[model samples]
Target: MEIQHHVSLKHYNTFGLDITASELATIEHENDISILSEVPDFSTQSLLVLGGGSNVLFSGDYAGLVLKNNILGKEVLKQNEEFVWVRLGAGENWHQVVLWSIENGWGGIENLSLIPGTVGAAPMQNIGAYGVELSSVFEYLEAFELKTGKIAQFNTTDCDFGYRYSVFKGPLKQQFIITRVILKLSKHPTFNTSYGAVAQTLEEMGVEQLTIKDISSAVIKIRQSKLPDPAVIGNAGSFFKNPIVANETLNNLKTEYTNIPSYAFDNSYSKIPAGWLIEQCQWKGYRKGSIGVHAKQALVLVNYGGAKGRELVDLSKQIQASVQSRFGIELIPEVNIV
Candidate 1:
């Protein structure tokens, strides 16, 4: 374990916002966690657990310790004729795990390729892309409880997954650090090619037969073209989640905005595309000072250069307000604002 004081966090987060932490600690292995409970400084101090830092925006300097989870490993825990279960270290990069699964003929997470962040953070937001979510393949997760300093394993049901939400971000927020996640993948494959531009991309590539690897490759290519690389320019992917509305409310909006793009989730509710709503408001390519909506994708908030976290939040609030006033829908911030 290496502990440092007053660390700058500009490089850790995808947003590239410079923030300071009073103290920073790195635990390189899972066993190092056993010694964590004895550290009075943590309970005595404010603490934040950070993974790959792709889905968070720091509002300001953190007043206490920032625990950087460096623990790493991935292994197939169990396998049989019917199914295979693999356990992943929380610190492992999520996209790497997806690639590994595809390489090994494990076929559930191919659609999730190229998503940024660590495996530990995946379940926090039930991270999804295409038509698959972590919850769809989740077996269980082992988490270390912050208050009790004890270990607890939560099954899929315990995680209580919903669109862009899970127990980790809700009732259990900041109460646990996920150490490991188990995923049940398939030996027999099922491919979902129905979402977004996936089918079109495949067609353009002249791909007649698709495998898990092919799907992963296509998704990666599509994502790279749409999202700005955090390494080049600063961004945290989609800033707001697609808002879910009651069926009645959706119908009412449809009357005024007849071409509103929506997908039915259940009999009583529908999910409207937030990007479409923002674009309709003419927010795309709209720049306000140093912060602006991504010219290519309305849902992505970008840092043009030297923009502060508050500026991003204010712009997001304006979008939220505009969407609500115009469509009678409240947009939810998907990026975790710390």
Candidate 2:
């Protein structure tokens, strides 16, 4: 564990905010956690842990220690005829894991290709795309508890997984740092191509015998067409979670806006596409100064070059206010603001 002082965090987050941290430390090994706790004044300093930094926004310079989780490894723990259990280090890139699974002929995560962030953040956000979620493949996770300096295991049930959420994002927020993830991948996969433009994109690709690679490529194409690359610009994929409303609520809105789009979340609720909602309010491509909503995808907010986290936050608020005022639905942020 190496700790540095007065570090610029511009390279740590997807938004590329140029903020400084009073101290920054890198945990490269599981033992590093114990070593970190033994550092001088480690107990009193406020801690901010970062993974791939894809889902985080730094509002300002951090006044405490920023721990960058870079613990990396990937291994197959066990396998049966039907399923294979893989152990991934927390700091491993999530998309790489998907690619690894594909390379090995593992089937389940093909629809989740190209989503950014690290494996540690995957379960915390319960990252989903093209109708597949981390919870579907998740077996369990091993978290390093800061308070006890001990490793604890949490299964899917313990995670309390939901849409863009888990126990780590709720009751256990910031209390423990995830160090490892165990995924249960299928040998024979059932493809989910109906969500969003996956099916249409697959058809466009002229796929006859559908394979995991084909689905992964299709999803990648669709996402690349819609979402902006954070490396080229600056963005946190989707800024807000798609809001779920009651059947009656959607029906009431349908009376006014006949073109309103929705999907069945369950029997009682409907999931309204957040991008559609934002676009209808005309916030898509709405740029001001440095920060603005992406033209290609309204759900994404971008920092042109030198935009701060505050500016993007303000723009998101404006978009939310407009969407809420127009449709009676609240837009909740999926990204974590620090």
Candidate 3:
């Protein structure tokens, strides 16, 4: 394994934040894990396992080792009459995996098309889009334990998936480096086009007979129309997770603003769209220097050109404070701030 010092992280992260890592190592294969764990500073210093760098913001220069996961492979492990079990390396691009599934007639992850990140990061966030989530198709995953240098497999039950949350971001945080993800995908397509603009986009595209490919195409279209590409505009996708509030709170907010949109979370709670709240707070299209709320989608925080991660962090905090002050809802960032 080659370890480079004072590595510029500008190209590593999708946000285009200019930051430096004290030591950076690239893990291209599973064998590299043994070598990396043997580094003298590996256990002594702080560590970050970066995938596609789509879901993180560096507050400043990192004073530790940054391991970039580049492990890549995809294979079918088993198959049944109804489903196909496939395993993929953590480093594979998520959208490409979705496309590969669609091409092979696997139908479970079609609604998740166009999401930016690596497969390894998907389970960490329980990534969801258009009424479907990673938990819906997850089978299990193999992770390399940092302390023991042993591989551990976790099933769906072990993950403890919640809205934009998983054990990888909780109790198991920084404890394991996910090496591979095993997914159970459907041989028969179950179409989910109910959320957001998916159905409308499908209609616009004249998709009368729905297929998994069509659903993926519709999702891609909707996402392209709403979210800005990180390559063109520096961003980490939806900066905040949609906050779930009590039913009573929704009713009270509804009394004042009847058009306040929400989805039923459960028996006593409703999930409010953070984007709507941010827009209502008048932050949408609001720019100050290089940092701003995305004009098209307020849920996304963007770095226009030369904005630092700290500036974006401050902007997100301001948005949260404004939302809480206005609607009594505290928006929590989905993006990991380091």
Candidate 4:
């Protein structure tokens, strides 16, 4: 394990907020977990287990130890007639994993293509895109318990997955460091192009007969068109979770707005698009100082150049306040603010 002090975290997060960690360590192997636990301040100091840094924002310099997961590997564990079980290291880039599955003709994660982050972070938020979520393909996971220094395993039910939420982000938060994820992907592809602009994008690409690859390509194209690349403009995609409201609330809103867009979330609930609500507030393309909402997608909050983490956070709060005032619905942040 290599440990450093007072490390700049500017490049560590996709949001590009310049901050520092008082102490930082890299876990390149399984043994590093044990070594990390032995640190003098392990029990007393603040600790954060980080992956690709794609889904987090640093409000200021992290006060304690930051363990950066660098564990990497991917292997097929077993395969049956219908599905193949594959285990992936926590630190592996999510997009690379998606492309790898596509290259191997494996299906199930095609709709999640181009999402920035690491495999370990996926389960934390039940990462989803297009019409599919990680829960649909999750089989199990192995993690290192920080408190006991033991390897623990959890299945789908143990995860307690909800839309963009999981036990990892709840009861198990900071309790274990996810080291590996096992996914059950289909040998036979079932394409889901039902969400967002997927079907329209596929049609525009002239994809009459769809394959997993085709679906992935269409998703990539649509995302690229709508989302600003982090390399160019720093951002964590979809800063807020789509608010789910009672059907009666939807009816009331529709009576006044008439153009409200929503999807049936359950028999009694409907999911309202956060992007639409933000756009309705006239925030799209809105800029102030070094932070702003991306013109192409109001769901994205961006760092134009040198925005501090706290500034971006304040901007998000402002947005939330505006949306709540306008629609009487609260928007919850999807991005983790440190």
User: In candidate 3, what are the lDDT values of residues 89-191, reduced to their tens digit?
Assistant: 9999999999999999999999999999899999999999899999999999999999999999999899999999999899999999999999999998788
Off by more than 4 A, model 4: none
The reply for model 2, stretches above 4 Å from the true place, is none
Q: Kindly provide the TM-score of model 3 when superposed on the true structure, using C-alpha atoms.
A: 0.98
Task: Tell me the spans in candidate 1 whose CA falls farther than 4 Å from its real position.
Answer: none
> Judged by TM-score relative to the true structure, which candidate is superior, 1 or 3?
3
Q: Stretches of candidate 3 above 4 Å error?
A: none
- As a whole number from 0 to 100, the lDDT of residue 234 in candidate 2 is 90
Task: Give per-residue CA lDDT, model 1, range 99-169, as digits (tens).
Answer: 88988899899999999889999999999998889898999999988788788999989999999999989
Give the alpha-carbon lDDT of every model. 0.88, 0.90, 0.93, 0.93
Question: Model 4, 312-333: lDDT tens per residue?
Answer: 9899999999999999999999
Residue-wise C-alpha lDDT for candidate 2, range 70-90, written one tens digit per residue: 989999999999999999999
TM-scores of all candidate predictions against the true structure: 0.97, 0.97, 0.98, 0.98
Clashes of each: 0, 0, 0, 0
Q: How far is candidate 2 from the true structure (C-alpha RMSD, Å)?
A: 1.2
